[model samples]
Target: MHAGPRPSILFVTDLAYPARGRRYCDEDIFLTSRLREEFDVALCHPRDAAALLDGFDAVVVRNSGPVLHYQEAYDAFCARARERKVPVYNPLTGRGDMAGKQYLVDLSAAKYPVIATVDRAGDLGLLPGAAEYVIKPKLGADSVGLRFVTPDALAAEVGAEPDGSVLVQPRIDFRYEVSFFFIDRDFQYALYAPHPEQRWVLEPYEPTTADLAFARRFVEWNDLAHGIQRVDACRTADGDLLLVELEDLNPYLSLDRVTDEVREAFVARMKTSVRALLH
Candidate 1:
């Protein structure tokens, strides 16, 4: 073992969270085990993160489940980290899903290659002509409260909710979904579910230069200096990629699906990133 002061990290996770199609605990367990080689690590539930972060050099949020489940606690932790100036992995500056789904509406307004999104009834005409629309809470995660409604029923469904509390989008019939994983702005790996019905049955994806360029656009837009990010998108029937979500907050790495060599490389990159944050 190397003799020196290993920085301490309070790794936040929900080891018991019942994430569908994924094992949150096993990924965190594997990550923490590898991280232990370079830092003094402690595991804590998201609820305990705010209270337990004082003594650690940094707080790393991983697989903590959706913040919607514990919004108050997660907000408190974020506020505390900011108030006390404690470094947080993902850096608390992400404008992606970490903030909310508002980015979708904003991106759509700017004509970015994202699924057509609108939160207001008047803007409903902006979306492409589709048989059904997908509506979900602006603060939702893990597909919570997601519903599909026909165009005729769209206004009632959207108007029933508190103004600006939900987002509506035309449900595109995409060919497949793909995700690009990045570490500190550098593309690391990509995975895709060939079958649209089975979103989690991922296979290693060899991204074309054009594909990488498409994914990188958002990464460049986010402008995050460090932290892990997952660019989730769907390939439309017309062979265009549109942003589905930008998961900057504790995106499940799906390490189990990748090769051992790729996993090792990811861990090494993470260790270096953490060290850079400390310095």
Candidate 2:
């Protein structure tokens, strides 16, 4: 395309996004540093991607923070990328939380094992009964504006027609949470936080056959071709996993938590995947 050997990439990230319980910048810094070995890489903020993308062979969107903060700019980038046919990592067809939490409602309607979810006032009964339920922006990220409310308060809040701005889910009383990481449909590793309150304190997890099966179902469901994915799940008191969220768009790899060998292998695999996208 550009008559050069190296495949140039515009790595989009927001190094300043104040992500609670996570350092988004640190992860991207580590990744882009490793990626320089195989490509002509440049980093930019999400708001600046559309302007510079035409010069790069591909745009690797990672740790760019929620698109809601810069919807107009992000929309322009997506529009231009598609019009010019610039390859986007994750391929933009992800049907999970990447697109929005709407897929959760869709999956729940189709009877998937995801936590019961609904966005409208009329659909509240579909969710399981609990002493309290969680309400959040349907298009939210990083647990922003999330609240737990009693059923009575929830009913009143739902009745207010609050701009159709939120989603509701039963407060799942799970024992712990686990995440299954994938690279283009291939399982890479699993990690868990033994304590629910300590979400970032992760340890390598060995999943059972059934657990892997459960996680794979969501990965297959999202159907992304080339990108990282993390299947976030919560274990019920009965020791079964329920799908919590499918993070396809810019899913943090948590690379620091893994063994060096695994991390290197992942970086190598990503380089190969990104290189294949040059075609």
Candidate 3:
């Protein structure tokens, strides 16, 4: 085990970021306040991480927002972290949204019940027949540049760029959306927005054994043994859960929505995971 005080952590975040329907600053403030008790913690934006990371035992990236907005800074941070062998929570090797939207195409091709996706014009034909399609950048976050287009318009709009320039997916007609939260691969409480229009209005959701099993599959696929993750899915008209996104990077915990008991449980679980990472 590495010897030290309970592992000094650099918690990366953007407190002032304006996130629609959610207060990004409020969530980060609450988390840091609790984490301060057991950790030597400092907060910084994603841009400064590369410069400050070498001084900390580990870097906890929380609520950092979309890297697409600050690509150069994010790239430098990842490169420096890898070069220095700095331990980054949620690690730098995540294969889901952390990497890009290419996983959508991969997962869809593998027939994982995900929304059908395509990255190229030639491949648009592969998408299932739908009335409308959603197009967004492959590296997008917070729904930036998302648009709905009829299939006929896609041929002119699809661009050939391998640098994660874009992604095309059918707009799923789902009843509602749910998110399953996890800490270091361990399942935590789940919350769902019963209404389709108000995505941020969440309520406590007790997952059945089958629901837990489905959520666990994605968590296992992610393979992160540290940090937190949120598996987002939509319930289709046919009563099936289809993968919407796997948020492995600074997934907003929505802690204020859960009960006191659930929130305490989550905090306790996070403490255990962070302590384990210290070794």
TM-score-based ranking, best first? 1, 2, 3
Model 1 CA lDDT for position 15: 99
Per-residue accuracy of model 2 over 224-258 as CA lDDT, tens digit each: 77888999999999887889999988887788899
Please give the lDDT score for candidate 1: 0.93
- Locate the minimum summed-lDDT window of 10 residues in model 1: 1-10
On the 0 to 100 scale, the lDDT of residue 174 in model 1 is: 96
Please list the Cα RMSD from the true structure of every candidate, rounded to 1 decimal place: 2.0, 1.3, 1.9
Model 1 Cα lDDT, one tens digit per residue, 20-53: 8989899999999999999999999999999988
| Estimated TM-score for each candidate | 0.97, 0.96, 0.95
Quote the positional error of residue 175 for candidate 1 in Å.
1.0
lDDT of each: 0.93, 0.88, 0.87
Compute the lDDT of residue 97 as modeled in candidate 3: 88
- Give the winner by lDDT: 1 or 2: 1
The lowest-lDDT stretch of 10 consecutive residues in candidate 3 is 155-164
